[model samples]
Target: MTRRLLASYLSLVLLALLALELPLGYVYARGELNRFTGAVDRDAVMLAELAEEIIDAHSTDMLPGLAADYAHRSGGRVVIVDRKGAVLADSGASAARGRNLSQEPDIASALRDRSATGTRRDAGTGAEEYYATMPAWSGTSVHGALRLSHPLGPVQRRVHEVWLALAIGGACVLAAAALTALALTRWITRPVHALERAAAQLADGRLAPAPVIDDGPPELRRLAATFTRTATRLHHLLQTQRSFASEASHQLKTPLTALRLRLENFEPYLDPRAHDSLDEAIGEVERLDRMIHGLLALARLENSATTPEPVDLDAVVADRAATWAPFAAEQQVHIAVAGQPAGPAVAVPGAVEQIIDNLLANALRAAPPGTSITLARRRTEHAAELHVIDQGHGMSATERERAFDRFWRAPGTHSDGSGLGLPIVRRLARAGGGDVTLQEAPGGGIDAVVRLQPAAPAEDRFHAGRPRAVARFAAHPARAPRTAGATAGARVPGGSDVRT
Candidate 1:
């Protein structure tokens, strides 16, 4: 940016200099040529007067000496011609003094009672030379013509020097402008840079400041102050939200649990026919408790502004599958771990576990006795996927689509689910730069998939210590043949919240 700004400034300066200097140089060259021409014509006329007496008397014996003296003083070639255009004297070639040499245009014009002064290029040397011719008159009868010529090399040299001086001045001006533009660019962009850093830090939940000094532009300084205040307010709002969730989770859970217990205790006092009503009331309270818990989890997940980090997805899957295995077995269902190594993936520090637990809890609820819940780990083009497949009746496209909506549940779902689990899972997954999706599992079940950004692979040495990690869970050879298959979906209630 600084370079671009400086270049723009220098370009304008160069154009201005070119605009002024080019015409001044052309005009100076023309003026110099005119001055040289006029000087030569005057000198030629003065010599022509001196030669008038000598030529009229036909006493041209000392004419060559006079021409030579004037030529030496004026740095030019001189020639004296008689009335008939015959050369009488020559400063350049004394041997050609008697030559008939008036065929030249300037000499002819001079002999015709006219003066000539102009410049012409030398045919042999390609150098420019100026010529001035004057006619000498003895009472209106032309006595002779005096012609003087000089090379324009000296005037051209002066013009070149002037051009060089102008170019140097332009370059110096451009350099100074470049330096000034660079300083100004830095001064103007400093506040912008600070605000950019602060925005990034805020995105990462750091709440850094956008500090600007008074030396910067007024608009930028005000912007920096406004940005700092806005970021502080935003950080405070989010902090308050997370704090409320954390506080509410602890504060509300016990009351809800106690309320459910109190409702159960009223079972004895209620009539036999009212026992169903008492049970229904207790169930609703429990549902409310779970619902509130899930809502708080979602709140924390959303407001924490947690950044994704590298997680050994394979290890996380294996640990979660193992943790849920006993529960599956208690229901006479096997937990089947399958698929290739998913390697490390980018996810929130504890997001992978919460996502797995929520999906597994729902899967266990859906799976039938004697069936299996399959924990499958696989890699897609740019992400790792953990699909919790259960052998229960799968959801329709509509149910799957609406599953992630907060507090949404399938129409015929019979469980006492709070309908907040799928939303929580999705929120956590997205916060980890991933997603949770529900699709039809092979052979009839819901495939609850959690996809995450693939991260740098773990070291081989680390994997070497866990050679039995061929599936989502560490292999148990003694129980390798255990029965396992497809479980629950996106909108099912979770068993517990794992939110650390």
Candidate 2:
């Protein structure tokens, strides 16, 4: 954009400069030519007056000395002819001294009492000349005519000088205009480039503030200001969305918990066939509840800008492996971290931990009991990376592509697990300026790479991940604690807490 604007400005400057110089230069050249022609006419008039005086002094015969002097002073060819068209005095062209002048239009016109002046090419030299002829009269009776003509060489030379000057002046003006245009273009374009970079950051969810640019044209300044306002508004709206989702999720948990508890209490009273039917009903409710929980977590992660702090990546992997060990044992799978916790783990809080837990649970359900699930974390240049790899029947490319979509699961996979696990991991990673991706694991397993922002150098404090327990706490009416002692064997019918 900057380059294009600069080019346009330069083009306009060149055009404007040409418009100002072209006509003025031509006019200057024409004025010089006019002045040269005026000089020729004035000399002709002066010579005619001189001829009258010479005739009045009683000299009709040729006056060689006076004629020579007139020719020298006029810088022209002088010819004096009588009333009978007999040449009287010839200055330079003396061969036709007695030649009749009646044949010449200018001379004939002068004989009729009108002055004649014009310019034409001289046949002798092939050069343009200005000529003026006036009547030589004695007491109102025209005796002859005096003609004076001069070549226009001096006038042409003056016009040529003007032309040269105009050429040089135009060149200088255009050069100066180009330089000025470049300077102005930079002034206008620099700020716009800055704004473009800021807009990109905003698009990428960086939420960076727009830069303050107090320079450039008035209109550009206004545009910069408008961009800043738009970025601010978008940031605010995103925050509001996150807040709304969290609030709604918190509010819905209470009823879901109470309803599950009531359903579980009634399960023992039903017959075996009825019990089996009741289990299916409970499973569907559990799926719905898991989906809502996933949504709430996704919203929270998307709205957060919190950076990772110092925590042991290996420890995180190991701890998650240990916590999911029971589920792995149930599936007859070996869940392990590839390496010991070597350094301070990146502090990813509860959001990231839950994402990992969900991914592990899904892998355990899909893979055979003997499958091996490995979790590992390593430091990277920009962040700490976590991997959850499972040696199970891996999904196809299409399945992997849609794996992170909310409520999306493979057709053959267990219907009991909600499809929100991978998406929740992705949201958390993105919120921390990181990302999550699924790939074919080494030797035909599923590999999930999760990244989180690097911790600050000095910080060791890690914000605890959102607690699974607190997340389950109900604010809805149905989930309030019952007064009587609860049965030890009674379990929440749907362990999942879903918020729509």
Candidate 3:
């Protein structure tokens, strides 16, 4: 953009220089030609008067000397022609003592009692010359024509010198214009580029203070000021929102705990029918509590601006699998861990664990008895992925699209889930500079996939010797190995393949 701005500015300057200089150069050359020609014409007329005086006095012998002296002083040739179409004297050489003068255009016009001036090339020297002729009259009877001829080479040389000077001046102007354009472009684009970077950081959830740029054009400076204010306001608003969510969750938790305790206290004094109703009430409270926690988690993840660091994916996966194993057993479902984690992956601290926990909770709610859930980690060239595969009634395309929406539940699914799990998982994943996707699992279920940034190679890290634990958990007895063919047709919405 800066280059384009500079180029455009310089182009206009060059055009302006050409427009002004070109016409000025032509006029200067024309003026020089006219001035030289005018001087020659005046000299020719004066010589004609001298020749007339000589002819009237019948002293033709002095005419040659007079013409020769004038020719030497003026740097021109002079010819004295009589009325009878013949040269009487020539300043150049004796060979022109009687050369015909009436046939020449300038001399013909001069014989008609009119002065004439013109320019023509000399055949002998191949150089251009300017001629001026005037008739010498003795009482209206033409005595002879005095013609003056000057070579055009000197005038052309002067014009060339003027044009060269103009060219040099124009070049200097263009150089200054180029420098001015570059400086102006830098001045304008510096703040604009800074604003662009700030905007990008904001979009990436970095709500820090924007850089202050107090220089450049007034409009740009004002724009930068406005941007700084806007970023500050936005950051404040987001921080306030996160604070509200956290405070509200904390505030609600006490009352909810008291309500649950009160309901439990009444359980011992109630009949079976009332006890069943009281249990339903307690379940609703628990659901609300879970929802509050989910909101707090989402807020925390959204507000966090922590940079991602390298984490051992194998350790996280194994730990999460072990934690979820007992819960899977309670649902009469088996948990299977498969696939080796490839090196350390990059993620926000504890982000992978939170993602795994949410996915496992959701899968447990959907999985039926005797179904096996698979926890797998896969690595690609640029990314590492954790996938939770379960055999359950999978969601449709529309449900998959809104799966990450808060409180959104798929149709025909049980109400045990708070629906904030997937949303929180997605928020955490994105906060870690990663993403979460839901796909149809093999054998009619859902695959919750989390993509994280791949860690830099060991040699590229500052502390290359730090050891990473590669946790390998034992597969459960009820776990069944998956076949590749069974997962062939599974695909994430928007055409992303989790298997890859």
All-Cα superposition RMSD per candidate: 6.7, 12.1, 8.5
Error of 1 at 403 (Å): 1.5
Task: Compute the lDDT of residue 311 as modeled in candidate 3.
Answer: 78
Tell me the tens digit of each residue's lDDT in model 3 across 247-347.
78668889998998999899889997898688678767766666666656666666666676787777777777776687567568898989876567887
Tens digit of per-residue lDDT, candidate 2, span 353-435: 55566567556545565778888767766767778888877878888888877677687654454566666666656654678
- TM-scores, all models, native as reference: 0.74, 0.49, 0.64
lDDT by residue (tens digit), candidate 1, 28-132: 989987888888878888889989988777789889899899878877888899988999888878888778768989889889989888888865578888888
Clashes of each: 8, 13, 0
Quick one: best TM-score, which candidate?
Answer: 1
What lDDT is reached at residue 288 by model 2? Answer: 58
Better of 1 and 2 by TM-score: 1
Q: Candidate 2: lDDT of 235?
A: 82
